[model samples]
Target: MNTSKRLEQALKKLYTAFHHNKLNPECCKQCAVGNILDNTDNWKYLSDSHGALELNYIGKVHQALGRKFNGYTPLELLKIERVFLNACNYKLPLHYKNEKPKNPTDKDVLFNGLNEVVKFLCYLDNISNVMDYTKLFEFENDKPKYKLVFTN
Candidate 1:
């Protein structure tokens, strides 16, 4: 299969795994998308954020693709972040250990977010090799902090 086809399959597997609460890194260990989603490995930098739909995840995608944000403007960043987070219902906290469960929303934000995320990822994957990572940020203390460039 072609790279695009393989990438799409990997993304589909991830989407299914996420819905089943089976998103552990080990499951899709051999796939590219799995490596990106794997908190314990390749894209481990992602664990700093919540789930796969967070803005942080988008930033991670940017970083992975060797792309960086346009340093002069943040308005674009705000717009993209709002859309992804809203689709993911990211403000809602996950309940663990019988913790207080928040009221559920009528909309299926997870599905919505995953759908958009997959589309975005597919786009990124298509152009994975040509991105310019150096433009992403201005350095502070020698650390590679990302500023995030939102793309169409």
Candidate 2:
């Protein structure tokens, strides 16, 4: 349960943005990587397009210098945005012709995007997926095997 400082901070920011209705997949300043970067749209410059995985010239320069924004590299930010948009059901690169949810700002849609982003973040840190609860449902001999515990 020991989470890295970067992961913990990113989760807190994402949680706050989700509940406050500030998380939006379309807006570069309100998307998943945006929220984690203190709602800045500068990360958009890292990639040639919104959901592109390749780094542009500026991004490549920053990556070469080992620069990190909010503890994530420029490439990492692009990947995070791609994961969020994909989970929200939007076609890659986010164009008008791409398929997207009927309501991009809907709470449920945003929740799904957040869930996937969280999984990706955990994957980057080599930690268990925090949103997973299947372990609590484990059963042996027809009895509950694991109990859900809440901690402060």
Pick by lDDT: which candidate is best?
A: 2
Those runs of model 2 whose alpha carbons end farther than 4 Å from true positions after fitting are none
Q: Please provide, for model 1 over 15-61, each residue's C-alpha lDDT reduced to its tens digit, 9 standing for 90 to 100.
A: 56565654431222322233333422333233343223343664556
| Candidate 2 per-residue lDDT over residues 1-152, each given as its tens digit | 98988999999999999999999899988999989999989988888888989999999999999999999999889899999999999998888898999999999999999999999999999999999988888999998898777889
Model 1, TM vs. native: 0.35
Q: RMSD per prediction, one decimal?
A: 16.2, 1.1
lDDT of 1 at 42: 33
lDDT of each: 0.41, 0.93
Q: In candidate 1, list every pair of residues with a backbone clash.
A: 66-133, 68-136, 69-149
Worst 10 residues of 2 by lDDT: 142-151
